[model samples]
Target: MSRLLSSLRDGKGFDIVLVAVPLAFLLVFSGLPLIYNVVMSFQAVDMFSLGTFNRPWVGFKNYVDVFSLPATWPIMRNTVIFVVCSIAGQFVIGFALALFFARGFPGSSYIRGLFLASWVMPGLVVGAMWNWILAGDFGVLNYALRSLGIISENIFWASNPAWSLWAVIVANIWLGISFNMILLSVGLAAIPRDLYEAAALDGANGLQKFWTITLPMMRSTIGAVISLGLIFTLQQFDLFASITSGGPANSSNVAQYWAWEMSFRQYDFAKGATISVVMIAVVMIASVIYVRSTRHEVRG
Candidate 1:
């Protein structure tokens, strides 16, 4: 016992203990719940059988049923649109801002730090704030657009079926921009200044330097950023709940929000679980990409 204690205090035993604790925690909390969810997806689950794990198994019927619904394809389409647009907008704007601030201008650090405020705020809070800005009659956005002659009238951002999804997408892009900027800024900073100087001496213009030096070096970072953005965007539910509620005839419904609506509002637990399982598969793919990207970065 004394030897065991000694090993734990100052040997590989300590490292084993460090790993074991978190492993145990994950198995209990994350792993078990994930297994349960998958099992539920295959079983016949409803409000009545929700309390027990002894429900009848239905195989892939839930998945078929979920897809057979008229709303499924449209919601999936919205999800695709939301994910693509949000990621593109956030990454482009964030990359631009990262390059701008990477110049290390006066007060740049302070200004960059302030941008993190958007990322730190809760999704619900951000949605509520954007709600006011997107209001049709007295919205700040409409006023600005009108003042700029971009539009002659107020736009009902959250209500109109045409604009509802876009309203949520815009808010999501705003929420994610700071996070993308910070990660991209780190990547930019890691690039050796000597490379740029060498390129400049060789008659490389700014555009040439960016294409030749900056992009190749940032490959891993970009991959990781886009994969993570997919995971986050797929899991985005709070913004839907607070901003659109998947409303206006389900024009803005996405997979995550639809899953919640099925589980709680519609009391279709099996279908909800099936939807979640599908999303889990997509997120797992993104996770693999993220892992590969980070591993490549570490090797570099």
Candidate 2:
């Protein structure tokens, strides 16, 4: 017993213990809940049977019901669009900003730090702020566009079915840009300056150097950023709740918010669980891609 205690107190056993604590915590908190959700997806669950573990096993009936719903495909399509567009917008804009700051202009670091403010702010708070910005009557966006003669009339960004989805996407992109920029900036910073110097000696211009050197070096980081972005986008619920609430005839509804609406608002727990299971599968695929990307990372 004394030997065991000593090993735990002063040896590699201590490191194992440190890892075990968090692992145990995850098993109890995260793993169990995830297992329960998966199990629930396969079971017929009502509010009455929710408290008990023993429920009717419905197999894939819930999944079938989920797919049979008329709104399912549209919501799934919207989710895909939201995820793809938000990621593209965030990554493209973020890469641009990262490169811009990588130039090391005076006060660039401070300005880049300020951009993190958007990312750290609560999503609901960001959504609320954007509410007025995208508002129809006196929103700054419309006002600016009208001032520049971009639109003939005030656009109801959040209310109109055609624009409502895009409205959320726009806000989501803005919210995600900071995170993407910060990660990409780190990736940019990790790249050896010597490579650029070598490329310059070889008469390589900015574009050629970026394509040949910067991109290849940052492959791992890009994969990580994109995978994390996909997960974050899938888990995004606060913005939907605050900004759109899946409004305008559910034009802006995505899988996550729709899952919540099904489980809580309408009490269709099984279908909600089904939707979440599908989302989990999508995230798992992204995780696999991230792992594959990391395998290609160049060693120093």
Candidate 3:
């Protein structure tokens, strides 16, 4: 027992123990549940069979049925739109903010810190706030747009089929902007100022310096941010639940919320598992991209 204690205190056993603890934790919590979810996707699962592992294996029937549903294609399309638009908006605005703050004006740090309020807020809270902002009547958004002469009438953001999805997307972009900005600010800070100084010596204009220097230096960060944004946007559920609830003929229903609806609300566990499995596949791809990007950044 003394020898074992000595080894743990000063030998490779300590390293092994440190790694093993977290590895075991992950195996029990994350790995097991993920494997179970994948397994459940293949087998026939319902409220009755949910308690046990032994069940009828339906093979690809769940997948086939999920695809066969009329709402499946539309939901998939909305998911794509949500992810693409949210990521684009978040990255563009975040990068702009990061650049703006990198200039280091008076009170810039405090103002930059203030942007994190949206990020730190719970998703449901953010969704609730957006619900008020996007309300058909007396909404701040409509008030602003009307004041700008963009529209004379109030837009029914949450109820209208055309605008419901966009309402959620806008809220998501707002919530994610600070995250992107903070990450990009780190990347921008890492870049050697000497490169910019040298570029200026060569008479490179501001646009040229940004296009050539800033973008190239931030490539890995950009990749990592976009990949993570894909995962986050795909996993977004609270906004849909609080804002639109996938209402008005499932106009804003994405895969994540649809999976919950199938599982809990409709009690179609097999279909829900199938939808989750599909999302898992997409997230895994994004994880791979994020890993590669960070690895490249470290290597550089």
For each candidate, the alpha-carbon lDDT, in order, equals 0.95, 0.92, 0.95
Per-residue alpha-carbon lDDT of candidate 1 for residues 1-300, written as tens digits (9 for 90 to 100): 888788987885888788899999999999998998898999998898899776999999999999999999999999999999999999999999999999998999999999999999999999999999999998899999999999998999999999999999999999999999999999999999999999999999999999999999999999999999999999998899998999899999999999999999988898999999999999999999999999999999
TM-score per candidate, chains pooled: 0.96, 0.94, 0.95
lDDT of 2 by residue, 1-300 (tens): 787788887874888788899999999998998899999999999788888876899999999999999999999889999999999999999999999999998999899999999999999999999999998998999999999999989999998999999999999999999999999999999888999999999999999999999998888899989998998999999989998899889999999999999999988788889999999889889888877766765543
Error of 3 at 164 (Å): 0.4
Per-residue error at 11 for model 3, in Å?
8.0
Q: Which sequence of candidate numbers ranks them by TM-score, best first?
A: 1, 3, 2
* Steric clash pairs (candidate 2): none
Clash count of each predicted structure: 0, 0, 0
**Highest TM-score: which candidate?**
1
Candidates 2 and 3 compared by lDDT, better number: 3
Instruction: Tell me the lDDT of model 3 at 97.
Output: 99
Residue 288, candidate 3: alpha-carbon lDDT: 100
Error of 3 at 80 (Å): 0.3
